[model samples]
Target: MNNTVPEDGEQLRAAVRERYSRSVGPLLANQPNSANSCCSSDCCTPPSTQDVRDTTSTDCCSTDCCSTSQADPITGDLYNAAELGTLPIAAVLASRGCGNPTALAELKEGEKVLDLGSGGGIDVLLSARRVGPGGFAYGLDMTDDMLAIAERNRQEAGIQNVQFLKGIIEDIPLPNDSIDVIISNCVINLAADKGQVLREAQRVLVPGGRFAVSDIIFQGQIPPALRSDLESWAGCIAGALEENVYRQLLQQAGFTDIEVEVTRRYTLEEIAAGGARASIAVLNEEERRQTEGKFVSAFIRARKPAKQV
Candidate 1:
């Protein structure tokens, strides 16, 4: 994995798009089914934590590849067993979210919800069920393969009130003040311009609408070298803003009652155990120690103030 961040805006966006596009192919091929056939005859069974540490040659940043082992602790055990059973098998298998936003978003009946970076439509399907037939759900994603899979999952689940749109999170395609609630799962940290993403979220939300998401957040400063790594950025590390900075950005984007609640914190030992050794491989022992307890998966909540008369 390349360790250097792309300095050019367009270049960075292209890099992210290409990485995700390549990952979707393998993920789609590996979707679990009744036959339980492997993606390939030579496919190794799902890897364990030790297996991930032993295999240092693979690109640990590739979501499709590394996630097959379930070594990335950030993405697992988010939804409960019953919740997983309710969605299409493909949706359940394709989910890569860090947290269960649908569970925490407190969705209500007859509400209109939009999911940013709605990979595989897991949250959208879940949200659709929560909001019921009287409500609607919209999923927006930039990757064609993910969108395709999400749409297929929606059809398979026989859901009628959900729609998927292709677009970047920084520039939502919805009209202003159109959404009742906005939700996302671990996808915001992948954006190169988070402030813009928040602004767009605020723009499309109705006054008093809620902003609820599960995302990576940092508590302390990360070394500049780590922050500049392209792999770290793609893996939801380098792009994570410190908790205070994250809250400030939300306030700057015109959101109020900003609250960032920590859901899970990652220790350095856990990182090495979780198949992200590549991210820490460059760090010296002391630098690695500095990272302990600094990174967290947070449930961020904020609101767009009600419209004034």
Candidate 2:
């Protein structure tokens, strides 16, 4: 139903670029319309920027990337507590994530935090407060539009300890072992080379530093047609590495204590509502049914071994 992999990747990237560019203007004003939130959908058309906060759908996840506390897998303790009230409006508005890294990261006060694929700086802004004036946060994104929006957010928030860098995750612009913690939200699966992402996460982090991310991980092998589907890739389903493979890749990259925890699985209806079928025809009945409600979004936590002398 979908085109080959390369085609999907390009389309997804384009959608991301366009959506962020459009949302940038709204983000700077700090009166963001929730409907404008951009995710893999500009590629997959998942939840609109605004639809992410629907209590009936997203449930416990706040649009604010700052809420990092743990919650029940089924009963939804995380959703009920809503422990992330400390974030700035910019953060809540710019958030385009599936999980909250701030809670999962277990960040200490004054430790440096780096957000890969920082987007409009939702996680970065949230992390800035956690680290306080003694600590710093760095948001790295490849999109110039996103970087500009982040900078505006930084200025508006009056946060001096945060900086935005324009770059990709596979080849980060930061120095070696320069960060104390790394956090990302639904961004890593988008990279063309996830291994390089793991490697870079290791390279930039100090020994014992943690990699906390909220991403989509597959339960099993995705269909070849879906795997090669660029729109699906952008939508965050196609490119997802299986759970076991993700753990293995982390270990191979010298990360330890790896944890891949599944939190939610999207229904076929949800996927279709979010626009996951945009690139291909929703023609095949089997394809439509197979894709319905099958993707899982989870929090991924791992650590780089303390430097070995």
Candidate 3:
């Protein structure tokens, strides 16, 4: 994967915003039987932005605003039956996560948690349940449509300790050192400025706070053509960082104990997109093969220093 994110920041943002906005129909419609990912032909859903999202839960889907890939390579089987059973079908369906950050985060009974790019509030609601009444969970997302879906799901779930905020991950609205733990689900990789995002995450967490997230990262080389494709970026595949770069960024952001553990490798066939006009079309069979083992889902962990230097 490339080290630099797409330079056209506004275009990237617009690509993301448009994709998620169209998803409003199926998301709020509360369609029965949840899809594995937000925008998949598997479930006949529209373009996805899981977490409202930073993508691909979403580092969410869509290489084209109206088109989608053949499989949800980054989403699926992250949530357990117990977790799924506890949430609304829409919330479960709207989930755009690469991993269950809440489960891996090991949230305590009284911890303030923040979910950057908290799409439909799945992690937020779950965190509220874990943190209990004394603690709180805040879900931040840039898409109002996704926020509406989150709010609807929140009301349906009847969980009181959670609030969904409207904002992007790069510029979190909360005060500095105001949070206990920071979590994101496959969303950070979607940001055009991942450095700023990590910095903001660092800024908001209390000293000694934790950073646990599920995201898509690369282990090896990515085609230069793919890196330049803005649509692939919107779909989550184009914008991810190599694992080493991810660790370096965290360290530069004043984090310690950083770790990037791969959970799954996306096979070549799984990355196929049926849509003729989809963004992944840039990758022919050879390009797809080159990408086979390079792309992976990872659980990244880091902690802010006990005292900032």
- Whole-model lDDT, model 3: 0.74
**Best-to-worst lDDT order:** 1, 3, 2
Flag the better candidate by TM-score, 2 or 3: 3
lDDT of each: 0.77, 0.67, 0.74
Choose the strongest candidate by lDDT: 1
Off by over 4 Å in 1: 30-71, 272-275
lDDT tens digits, residue span 218-244, model 1 = 888887766887766766777788888
Give stretches of model 2 more than 4 Å off: 1-4, 7-19, 22-90, 279-293
Deviation in Å, model 1, residue 157 alpha carbon:
0.5
Best of the two (2, 3) by lDDT: 3
What tens digits encode model 3's per-residue C-alpha lDDT throughout 164-198? 99988989999999999999987887898999999
Candidate that beats the other on TM-score, 1 or 3, i.e. the better one: 1
Q: Which regions of candidate 3 deviate over 4 angstroms?
A: 1-6, 32-41, 44-71, 273-289
In terms of TM-score, which candidate is stronger, 1 or 2?
1
For residue 31, what is the lDDT in candidate 1? 35
